[model samples]
Target: MTMKFPFQIIDLTHPISPDSPSWDLDCGFTHSNFIDYEDCTSEIKFRVQQIHSPLGIGTHMDAPAHCIPGAASITDLDLHRNYLLTQSVLINVSHQTDENYQITKQDILDFEARYGRLKKNVFVLFYTGWEKHWPNPEKYRNNLVFPSISAHVAQLLLERNIAGIGIDTLSPDTADSGYPVHQLLLQAGKYIIENVANAHSLPPIGAWTLTLPWKIINATESPVQLIGLVR
Candidate 1:
């Protein structure tokens, strides 16, 4: 079928590999070739690979079950919610440092004041310029001061009926043991996309996003391929 609107697709996911940086607690991504073409004897050479990694590794989407008990899992997430074609808004919080940096409700209000009100079901993205440190576990994961979304800001987005939230960092919350933003968003049946790349390439508004997550039954989260369909 032909698309109604022509779009320039912008990838927003980082390549997953052994070198990909994951949460300190999650297992590192790895892959090995099980069947190589060099070992094939048949006329048609076959190759197979085995992969092992945690669900939260790489660019992924978190289901409500990730933090909320008795909530929906990766497979239970609505397809419409996982794959959405709606307006997206990018809030530039890149200037804010990790030390004492927090995205507050006031930040949302200020963004609206400058870029206009956020539309319902809009995919809200935060560009913290964190992707510049991609693939470097030391700089990207350990030493990085990731800006986190405050609980109040999360509630504000919920009130706006946002489809989901994405960030160019390992997570939407700080490295604290308790993640209030994740708890609030997930418990509300809203999804969160983490480790998003190229967020800075998107505009403050008017971009459309398409996020595709793996269908893993009863899984709390799944890696995703997020794309921005720019006009």
Candidate 2:
């Protein structure tokens, strides 16, 4: 049977490939043809490829175990409960902030003032306009000085009991910041999605996110395909 849906879907994931940008200085994605079409026999017409990628490469999710000891891994999250379909809020801070800006608690408060107080259990996505630089890894990474969420903002989100947070850049924390935001959120059992693409297309408050991760058991992170379903 064919199925039908009634929402406008927007892809929020970057294409993953060997050339995709990496959070780590030296690591990136790699893949190889494991079974080529040229080598296929009469009985086998399929070709297969093997991919090797850092868990943090491209658009991905960081499970609680990413920063917290003995916490839930990617596979540990229940698809239906944690990620399948979730409410979301977009907080855009592109206009007033620069490349090195740190998103503060006031940024969120301002968003709330404009959009109304955030409802609980919603995924908060930050559209920093950083996505425009995604095609240039040098600029996207920006010498590790890209915009990020301050620890203060992270704590404020935690207080609101959000399901998770997403950003259009490499991470919520700067590379040199020692991951204070990561530790705080992950320890509280919240997941994080980084390198989200096409966030500009989503509305500020009504879009719903559907996150599908490459589930790997006991792994700290997983590459994810995120989609926004909007009316």
Identify the leading candidate in terms of lDDT: 2
Positional deviation of residue 152's Cα in model 2 after best superposition, in angstroms: 1.0
Per-candidate count of clashing residue pairs (backbone under 3 Å): 0, 0
Q: Single out the weakest 10-residue window by summed lDDT for candidate 2.
A: 19-28
- Those runs of model 1 whose alpha carbons end farther than 4 Å from true positions after fitting are 1-5, 25-27, 81-83, 98-100
Q: What pairs collide in candidate 1? A: none
lDDT of 2 by residue, 1-231 (tens): 988797999999999876676776555677888988888886768788898778888899999999898999999888767755788999988895588889999999999999988888899999999989888887787788888999999899988988899999999999789899999999998899999999989999999999988878899998899999998
- The lDDT per prediction is 0.85, 0.88
Error (Å) of candidate 1 at residue 219 is: 1.5
Error of 1 at 78 (Å): 2.1
Count: clashes, candidate 2: 0
The alpha-carbon deviation from the true structure for residue 67 of candidate 2, after best TM-score superposition, in angstroms, is 1.0
